[model samples]
Target chain A: MKKLILALSTAAILSVASGAAQAATKVCFLYVGSKTDGGWTQAHDIGRQELENHFGDKVETVFLENVPEGPDAERAIERFARSGCELIFTTSFGFMEPTLKVAKKFPDVKFEHATGYKTEENVTSYNSRFYEGRYIQGKIAGMMSEAGVAGYIGSFPIPEVVQGINSFLLGAQSVNPDFAIKVVWVNSWFDAGKEADAAKALIDQGVDIITQHTDSTGPMQVASERGIKAFGQASDMIEAGPKTQLTAIVDTWGAYYIKRTQALMDGTWTTQSTWDGIVDGILQMAPYTNMPDDVKQAAMDTEAKIVSGELKPFTGPITKQDGTEWLKAGEVADDGTLLGLNFYIKGVDDQLPQ
Target chain B: MTLAEAILLTITTAATPLLLAAIGELVVERSGVLNLGVEGMIVMGAVVAFAAAQLTGSAYLGALFGMAAGCLFSLLFAFLTLTLVANQVATGLALTILGLGLSGMIGESFVGQRGVQLEEIAIPVLSSIPLIGNLLFNQDLIFYISIFSVFGVSWFLFKTRLGLQLRAIGDSHGSAHALGISVIKTRYLAVMFGGACAGLAGAQLSLVYTPQWVENMSAGRGWIALALVVFASWRPLRVLAGAYLFGAVTIGQLHAQALGFGIPSQFLSALPYLATIVVLVIISRNRRLTLMNTPASLGQSFVPDR
Candidate 1:
């Protein structure tokens, strides 16, 4: 009688599990840092929540935060695949190789990689054009700085950071040909103390304006304490430096995340590479604050022009670090050159790491 | 402030935490107990300090709480290695892993919150002096404590009777035990002191260093402090010099980049570590000095045989 009852209970549990499985799409995310990092990972996690809010019961979302970007990442991805995750999002540049490695093993599961270039049959690559907003920050820095020197704190000398540096300088040079920038590579993506020290070091060396490509509010807080102008990266960090933040470049991935998950649910998902910018609403500028009225107006004008295709930040007469011409007059930078950008522009004073 | 003055101030700020952590670990090793959990204790201190400060709105109370947390965390190591006689190296490593994971869990809610900055003490006439004024006079409480601790530790190690007993136990725990020195009790106190110092270093990071709490915010500084202890030959004064030298290299690299030096940042960022190794090589060449300073029984599990 006990065996018969146990068999009946097992059957009942299996039926309920199958019924729930048929009704929902299991989506998962692998984050390189903590969800409360207040920067890069937090921005991505916000997008994941938006997907849940949009689909509610039809979609089940789970995420593993602070997953290191190596063999551990591959393990996390494969675990998600084994647990019936129909789609997984690997949201970090270092996770590119790991995502590709796991995608090959789980041919049936779809994978989306943020800020990565590689793609497989099951893997799709997506990145927001953060350089677009960086250009606006450069313009603001150029117009407002008393010293005409902006200090840029970079995480690594990757193409992404290099692209932002070049875009910032080009934007600044357009307004003031003599605008100078000093770049400091902190060598890590998210150490608050190091980032703060880098900012202080820059400020001491006569940089009146501060900006960072690294994930943290350290530089912003330092800027606030020092009473210097700064721009935020990855997320709105005005709370960190309310009085000092000129503006922020916020990464909004909610629409993209929801759309991709919806596509998977509808069986229309396919491997693709997407590098969306301001026009696509992927990169957004926070409300212009802590700046003069005229400067704010100029920033808004530049934003509108970029959105309307009337202006391109990387257009024409650009020079490489070695004084070689990168783009002649009237020529806009192509996606290939921007994606693999390895050299600094002529005005940047620091050397790029090979 | 002049550019030179500003750079010096940054260097001082950078060096103090390393000095604090290294000095604390120096005492632990000098007691013949090598606690590898400096990194763990630091993070625990940082998180607890940040949380306590945020809750109480007093940075001092928060710092004390941080030191308490670190001391309590080290007691686990003391119990495992000193009482239960676990392998010192393995237990210390486990303590670090446990501390890191536990701190992250405890710090989850505290992330993104702005911390209260420790107020600096500006002396009247001293702060007004030119060039060296602000650099020397207008410093935070932790800076004064860190500098004072250096002298205090030096005196305790060389001049105090208890200090001699502690060092004696470190040199030969068995001999000290036969002499009725209570080896376990002395080592336990030494480990707790090390934990408190590591905790204070972490509080410096959260409350004074960046004025915020971020996960893993200690960011390998704990490991560097451990290296500093070895690099300084376990001496308090040498630890001060090594830490400041490291601090100078760190801030100096940024200055190099800001000046637009055409060197790769990877190479520049490696300067502090490279200097540490070079200094270590130089110091190790003097075998007698190193032998005199290093604890003979470091990293050994002490079984009382009672």
Candidate 2:
């Protein structure tokens, strides 16, 4: 009688285990850099961590980091598909073409690309409207600056960087009419020395405030040492320099990552574009300790207004860097104009690099 | 500082890494062995240096490890060129590919982890000297070392008996062999020196220059270094000038865009590379000039029997 009871319990456990195995959901993440870089990949890794936290044993996750953004990316996606990944996320702009190529071959697999524009039946794209936060930070830079000169450590000459710079200038000029943003393009996304040197050169030229789109906190460290103020690029770099860091444009991919993974597990996954901004809470302001109270209060008010759709930072009366009227006063720019922003506004010191 | 001053500063820093590597390659080529694996060696050095620095928290030790790693990889080239007597160009190409793959694999863990950066050791009055002062002396120790190496190499090649012998071997291995100069030994020394220099360049990249290792971060700098050697016409001082010129080209692009002073950004971005090609064209304009300095035994099979 004892043997029979034990045998029955073992059989039941095995059946349950089999059922759970069959119900498991698998997800894959492809990264262009190491997750530890504290840059693009780190943010993506945070999102992946959220997926794992929310789903627990219901979902399985794997990632391939430091994959090149071109042909290699497509190969990585194909590998994931062959390895039974139910969903794959390719994170990088250059991965767009490769992601689409792999998506077509793996129709059964769901694909979500970060910072890409392509979409397919099984593929979707999502990117933060980071410029929204840049515009806000620009407002702060304008208000707090004793020097009219603001140094911008630019990463690339891509459309994304262009958009951010333009939005930043527009926001700054709205507050400080005399503000001039002197940009220094390092042309690399993650070179600390180059970023630091660019910041120093700007400071050498009498610019007191700085901002960077580069990944490393070396620039912030330099700024702190030089007794100048600066804003963080992608992540909150307060730890890198608490004194100099006025604020940061934080990329909070966790909520969206968790939400999307859960959707996949629940069988509600669908291709879609996500252009969330301050309203949806994906882009948030890091705690503003260095900012003055008045400046802080103004930023808070602007944030609230932006979230409520009551304020449009890129409103008209905009003129190009070359003095061309881009928008009449009170004229709001459509999504298309902003999407294809090919020029800078007035008061920008450098022309857009070809 | 004017735009020119800013551009000059950027160029000097940018050329530091390339100049170190090219000088090493110059020595290697002078010995009549072409080691095309500089890119690979550089990557290996960077990854090894970064990993060592991260573990020990010592930038100096990290640099040593990088040089050691580069030397270790150079043995493959030496073995192939010296013992097996393989085709120099092909062996060098294989070395580059191998170094790239191996370094990429090893660099995976070191990626994104910041290593310690080199501090500038500036001389008092030298660093304070006007425009030229900031542009030249205010740089880190590596820059001074690179400049010193140009004179060092010039003296070694012209004033010293050993330098004369090395040049003789490069000019004609047969005649040098007849004079009883150990062909294999001289070649090995040159290659090893080249390897060490490549390692230093890699160390500078991860330690002083960037302070981080990204996969394949050498990013064709090695190829450009090779071109600089050709542009320098195998002269050390000229190589320095070529490197600085390339550096200026690179920084000039960014400066034009930064001050948004009015040039098309993309065109500016491509200017440095275009400038390199143009310079190469001009250097080769007089076919006789290249023919005069071209090593007679370059890329040639140097078998004792031949």
Candidate 3:
């Protein structure tokens, strides 16, 4: 009788485990631009593929590309929900509201938004600390640039981009106190011609080193053509400018995507916000090139220190554009201030667009 | 390069594409066809040109392919509006939408791939001259072509008999038809010319401007070219002037920002469009020029009395 009871309990547990394993997790991704955009969207797509590779047949993934941010996004998300997507990842900041709206309607479905702030019971936000990589590029720019002037091509004046600019300047100032940065806001995320034109304009004005927060390889191509140095953003752009690309700040979303997908599969998914940096492997630096060994070593060291929390890009003794002390001496910047960063720090030469 | 020289060179680069597209559209509008699909055609030209250049390893061949693609795309519009009697405005809009979507699909694999840049043609003796040489002789083949197009278009429209017939059709299709001129045939040729020009403009973008493929790389240059046609009052020379003027404003704003003039970047970015509006207002104030230069049957669908 005792052996029969144990056998019955083992059979029940095996059935439950197999049942959970057998149900495939249907995951959907909504992208703001083409998957082959060669930048941000491309990075996310790569991560999605990595997720697929990691999970194999246990997971099924679907995605809709070029979904606009507003009402159309809501429709896309709702369609995914209606199609029985158990979890959806809206991979652009503009889809925050739509993701939340769909999450509310489909309470059982999980939603993840990238580079967003809002969250609910079923909605989670995730972002990588891209500024950390920008900080390292700043250091390299300050050292390598002949004119000590770097140009930054920004897509928008949002906190995210502003944070990167500030961190970059801070990194440059650390290496060269006299280092100056000129910023041009193209007011767009992916205008290749405008970005190239902006790069040329900056170079013409004595900017030798260029960096862009935009989504195209245009600036890097311009840098290569003009014989100037530049850093790539979001993806490794060495192919775009083999001679000019010093290093690239690559966004690695694969691990996070895998983690979240695993959580969903394990039935342990919950609403939470995650802001990870180099330590968590969300932000990665491409192999340093077009620089001396020592310079490359120094960049790698700085990256290591950032990951180890030994160096903070936005330490105090920082002055805002309006001549106000933002952080006290020796005090690192807090998340709140960083999240709402809108003003330029002291060494930047250009005015922040209001 | 001196700041002035740099600025001038930048302006030339900026203006050439607009000049090319505008010159072509000028002819189309002169033939009484309104095609707002220049943007789509330009983008199609850019991707096709990039792909061809990458595959063939020759920039010149890439440019030819680009022009051919544009001509082909414009042929679709001609078939719809001219033969099928579709509404020109709606058909043009549909063409733009279709072109944009189709280019994106076609360009998916070409993205992130760099193409060979069109080499600059430096006329040895002439290019040795100071500012003028660098401005004129030391330019790429496309730049020379764009300038030649200006003179060629001006001569064709004002000096040539075919040009007069095209203008007549634009002014009054009915009068031209009754005068024994084939209105539909002339319009078809003009539209094809415009498409070819728009394609060359796109090729200049991918092969010379940035020398790479990116979705929507043409940005709003097509619209700007369209606006340039209106700002120039449909004249070829004025189109050249307006394009360069807009280019100067564009580069000037960047200079202003780099100089740290304390102006907000947003306003600096807005300067180009603002200048466009101001120039348009100033030019449109002279209503006689606009009316005299304007095509009377512009945008009107000509269903020849069949």
Top DockQ prediction, candidate number = 1
Over 4 Å off, model 1:
A1-13
Q: Rate the local accuracy (lDDT) of all candidates.
A: 0.92, 0.81, 0.92
Model 3 global lDDT (CA atoms, 0 to 1) = 0.92
Tens digit of lDDT per residue, candidate 3, span A1-354?
999999999999999977875577888999999899899999999999999999888888899998889999999999999998888999999999988888888998899999999999999999999999999999999889889899999898999999999899988888998888888888889998888888998998899999999989999999998899999999999999999999999999999999999988777998898999999999799999999988898899999899899998888899887789988999898887888888899888887777
How good is the docking of model 3, by CAPRI class? Answer: medium
Candidate 2 lDDT over A1-354, as tens digits, reads: 999999999999999987886577888899888776666778888888987888788888899987887778888889999998998888888888998898898889999888766799999998888888888888888898888778898877776788888887777887988788998877788766567767866776778899998888768876876799999877887866778888898888888877787788778999998777888767788987688899999888877888888888788898888898989999998766776667778888886756
Model 1: per-residue Cα lDDT at residue B255: 90
How far is B185's C-alpha from truth in model 3 (Å)?
0.6
Query: Where is the poorest 10-residue window by lDDT in model 3 chain A?
Result: A17-26
Measured against the true chain A, the candidates' chain A TM-scores are 0.96, 0.93, 0.93
Q: Candidates' interface RMSDs, in order? A: 1.0, 3.8, 1.1
- In candidate 2, residue A261 scores what lDDT? 79
- Candidate 2: residue A194 Cα off by (Å): 4.3
Q: Can you write out model 3's per-residue Cα lDDT over B1-306, one digit (the tens) per residue?
A: 787888888889888899999999999999999999999999999999999999999999999999999999999999999999899989988988898899999998888887799999999999989878887899999999999999999999999999999999999999999899999999999999999999999999999989998888888889999999988889999999989999898888877877788887788788888988998999889889879999999999887785
Which residue pairs clash within candidate 2?
A: A349-B259, A350-B259, A350-B260, A351-B260, A353-B265, A353-B266, A354-B264, A354-B265, A354-B266
Superposed by TM-score, candidate 3 places the C-alpha of residue A59 at a distance from the truth, in angstroms, of 1.2
